[model samples]
Target: MSADETPQGYSIFRDTMADMTFPEIARAAERRAVVLWGLGVIEQHGPHLPLGTDVYMPSELLRRVRRLLAERGIDSVIMPPFYWGVNQVSGAFPGTFVVRPEIVIELIVDLIKSLKKDSFARLFCISGHGDALHNRTVHAGIARGADEAAIAAYFVGAPSFFARVGIAADDPHILPTHSEVERPSRYFDVHAGKFETSSMWAAYPGLVRDELLPALRSTDFGVEDISEWRKGGDHARAKTPQGYLGDPAASDREFGETMMAQHAELVAAAIAAQVGAAR
Candidate 1:
């Protein structure tokens, strides 16, 4: 689908909270509409992709999720994208904007509180960025918000994130995928590799610099290399001088669409289960 085209039955103005008026929002809240919020970061994603890749990817995924929810007879509200997130690993890159972890936590807490004040009870925080610290901070914020505001808040993320924080994959606050999205370059495509490049191409082809793909080589990193890159600053730059990992040339739009669709399926299923159980 093109950027301007909405799905057959989806209406952005009616479903998106940011586009709704106070009365509409109040009505949605009365109907127990679930809120879907996309969390991302402004960071470099190699030479070929735009810096807003993180924001764009999750925003697109959430759009698909919203459509899927509508089809399942579920009411939902999509929040405006939140891209000001912590970017610790890629902070060395020029386009990266690293917010303080405490600030991110505070911002998330405030957002949740505001939603509660507006009578929103259930929130799903879906993030495109996978920085361990960033995920942890967001989780912390959600926890605090749920406790203080008495709202049902969930952090939808990968199993790796839940594992990293020592939280069970099946935790009540977490909606993790059953497994990682299967792809040929799964291991090496850590950063702006084939997976991300293709995803951007499929969703927003105009934003991607396709011409640069042919000339760019892959920067596949092993475990040791990843450890070095995680150090940030000079270490990360030294590990990925070109500011990307994996082979962009290997990206395929079809694979991107498949991967995103699979993810949306998993996320939509999880959301449906929660919504049903609540009823």
Candidate 2:
């Protein structure tokens, strides 16, 4: 677990988990002060990215962060990903697997409780979805649950304590870019937007569609502000109407790599704060 033995230098998820026995894994967890709990969803990420995009991003980020921890002689393990979240928007979409907010809180609380029983002390939840507010609330729920158990918990969000020194709140699109693949232009696609498209292109390039973005129409819910940005707004009809938010016409791999690098750094710094020698 020294500074040079980080999982970032090598791929952990891609590698087999069989290498470490239960005792070995538990031993590693006992020696470490922090555990990263990834929360993602099996919902639509525009047409460009796979339904598993949410799951992949956090795991990838953790891989890099682990590398940094190894550099600092701090060892942390990425817990199994929790793939269910509040996904009301993508309910109309084929692959969307929505979980009620209450369920999210309870299930996460149970997971943390179980982990605490096993000797892990601190927990961090890293999530991605349309429900930022809901996710933050869920984070709070986990923290409260952990507190009841006398453990600490936090969320790795852009504006939270883990903020990267130079990263802007609006820089590098948070969602995907769902349009064309070549020479993509930056469009106002927030849901099925260009940023998401670029990210999907980087992670699962074969899943993206290069044409048919301009024809999409906007799906405005009657509730205006309240319903517009939610998962129920218009997920199934992204290509026909407003299924996505950003324009995916200009997405490319280069932008994806840059975003990944930045995101990984932020994740690493956050994990460092948790696993660094000081704690």
Collision pairs in model 1: none
Model 2 poorest ten-residue lDDT run: 172-181
lDDT per residue as tens, model 2, 127-167: 65545545654665676677677776666655531232222
lDDT (Cα) of model 1: 0.82
199: Cα error in model 1, Å: 0.7
Q: In model 1, where do residues sit more than 4 Å from their true spots?
A: 4-15, 164-170
Number of clashing pairs per prediction, in order: 0, 34
Judged by lDDT, which candidate is best? 1
lDDT of each: 0.82, 0.59
Best TM-score among the predictions, by candidate number: 1
